[model samples]
Target: MAMERANLLNMAKLSIKGLIESALSFGRTLDSDYPPLQQFFVVMEHCLKHGLKVKKSFLGFNKSLWGPLELVEKLCPEAAEISASVRDLPGLKTPLGRARAWLRLALMQKRLADYLRLLITRKDLLSDFYENSALMLEEEGAVIVGLLVGLNVIDANLCVKGEDLDSQLTQGDVSVERDTYKQSRQGLDEMYNEVRRQLKEECQLRQDVENELVVQVSMKQEMELAMKLLEKDIHEKQDTLIGLRQQLDEVKAINVEMYQKMQVQTHTHRHIIQQLEMDLKIEREWRQTLQNDLHRERDSVAQLSTEALQINGLKKEFHRLQDENVQLKTICEDQEKALEELGSKLSESKLKIEDIKEANKALQGGQVWLKDKEATHCKLCEKEFSISRRKHHCRNCGEIFCNSCSDNELPLPASPKPVRVCDTCHALLLQRCSSNPT
Candidate 1:
């Protein structure tokens, strides 16, 4: 899956490169048409004043069209965004002004292409819709160029009619001149109306562009603020990760020690069990000997008194063995209870460790720590906190201080806003700033 995504991104980058080149070529073609535009203006002026022979190809018509035929506005939502930026530029009423605007737009276009390339070349960054939107801008450029050419052609045709009217007047032809003059007058009126309509459209377009630019500028500022916030969050998380890793190592060491202790406990329990087994075996042997002695006495009744005394001694020994057995069982039960208590302590220790971990996590996640009110002196300056000089807390180090010792407000990574820091923290921050000046 990863390999396929990489391949697709590479292909998209190549396409973006091709599109950039095409846009550059389009701009160059427009630049080359400047001379032709000047020549067309001159020819039109001559045709308007005096009749002259003219060729259709004299205007050097641009025929290098290579963009989409569809309306870009309909295809690409981003086209409006690009057009909005054009309003930020100064007006282009003169030749020099237009050229400057064109150059600046060209630079902007190149920059935009670089930005787009970076975005699309990243995996899953460019969606299908955005891709289509990019291609739409290319068609929009083509349409603008085509419109310029069409406007020049219309101007030339209008001039041609003027020249014909002039010719009829020079030949002293009354009726023909009157009709041609009226027709020219009517054409001029229509041309004037068209120009006025185009002017109104241009003004409206400019207004829309201005509104869009304001919106874009505001959005850009908001994005920059958001980016700063994210960067600070990342730094804080990295610090938390380091702290957690240290705690993990300590927990691992504790676990190892606990394992060793449990092993020792198991050995002790095994030893206790072995001692009980030996005591039980010895008691069984002694009981068997007593039974044999009793059988021997039954076989010879003449030795009854002697056997009776021996039997009493055996009974007393039996009673002593029973007491010893009971004591041994009691000792085992006591040891088992001690072992259960030890296990409970281990479990309690584990729970305490987990609670400490949770507390540490909370502190890292911006839970504020305050100094105890019992403290009477500043931690850094050792100054007494009095009614005149109140106690203050450093947001960074969570230390109590006199108000003068903790007066600096600085941007803290854990907080969204700047916070009061102690003299020690402020000095450290300054040193860090000097070490890594941006």
Candidate 2:
């Protein structure tokens, strides 16, 4: 049973591989302008070859062939549909279908291997079904028998009528036993021949399937090789695409760097140009200032020239003034000598005037002193010649005298013979006269 299961698994795997190979081959042919019918033949060839490979690989599990119909029913239900559809054919419905179905049932029951062997070797009776549609009919009939067995509609004792006959003959009398034996032998032979015919058809159908499977396996291998080649090409193209993309990226980066460098240079150039422009503007202003200073210096020079000319004119006037001053100095010297003489004369005149003034002042002082003395004298004279003393005479002279002078004894002169005399003198004369009086 383990060997049978392993064989089923391997067959399934091969069937799947064949189906895949067929589909791939069909697709390849369709992708081009290849003939459709040719493509179909190629696909069928691939399927047949793959199926044969599966059958050979599973050959050790030949006992599983007894239930090939069961396997077909379970694993390839689509094959069952094809079988059912073909069962309606006139030839397939006749004794051939019934006989094939019975034999498959007996094989699934595993009652007799020799019966199965006899069925597979009978080529003459199987040739009719093989010529009509052996492949389709055999596969379908086997599947039906397997189904019926699984359903318990059939049992391991495939000779159901023979069992009944043996039971009936046992219940009859012993005198007809030899006839029963002969009839039993004939029935077994007939059953064996029919089983042989059906099994031969099944074997032929299996052979045709194996041949088709071989063609399919060959086509499958070729398709697998083509797929490997296509995969390798795709990988190589992908690597080349990646390399080109990397190079493109590097170029873009280089372009970006160059653009940045250019921008920096442009900025630097613009800055330099701006600085030069500023320098030019400053130089222009400086030139204007120098021009203004030059104009001012020219004006100053012109003014200085005018001043020099005026100074020259002033020098000539100064020389003339110096000569005039020298001549005036000479005239001033003569005038100064004359003025000195006049000053000496003026000094003499001043001295004379001073002397006159002094004389006048002295005369005035003398006149004052004289007036003062005359006043004193007049006072004294007035005091002395008082009216009371008048007519006094001197006694000696026998002249009249003041009493005060006469007392002194000095003679007062007689009134001079009209001249007044001191009383004393008068007294003396009187005396002398008296003495000489003869």
Q: Each prediction's TM-score against the native?
A: 0.17, 0.15
Decoy 2 TM-score against native = 0.15
RMSD vs true structure, all candidates: 45.6, 47.5
lDDT of 2 by residue, 60-148 (tens): 52111212322333433434543343344333433223333433333334432333223324434444323333321234323322322
Worst 10 residues of 1 by lDDT: 62-71
Q: Tens-digit lDDT track for model 1 on 155-246?
A: 11111122232231233334433443354455556667998999999899999999999998999899899989989999999999999999
Task: Pick the lDDT winner.
Answer: 1
* Model 2: residue 385 alpha-carbon error in angstroms: 99
lDDT of 1: 0.50
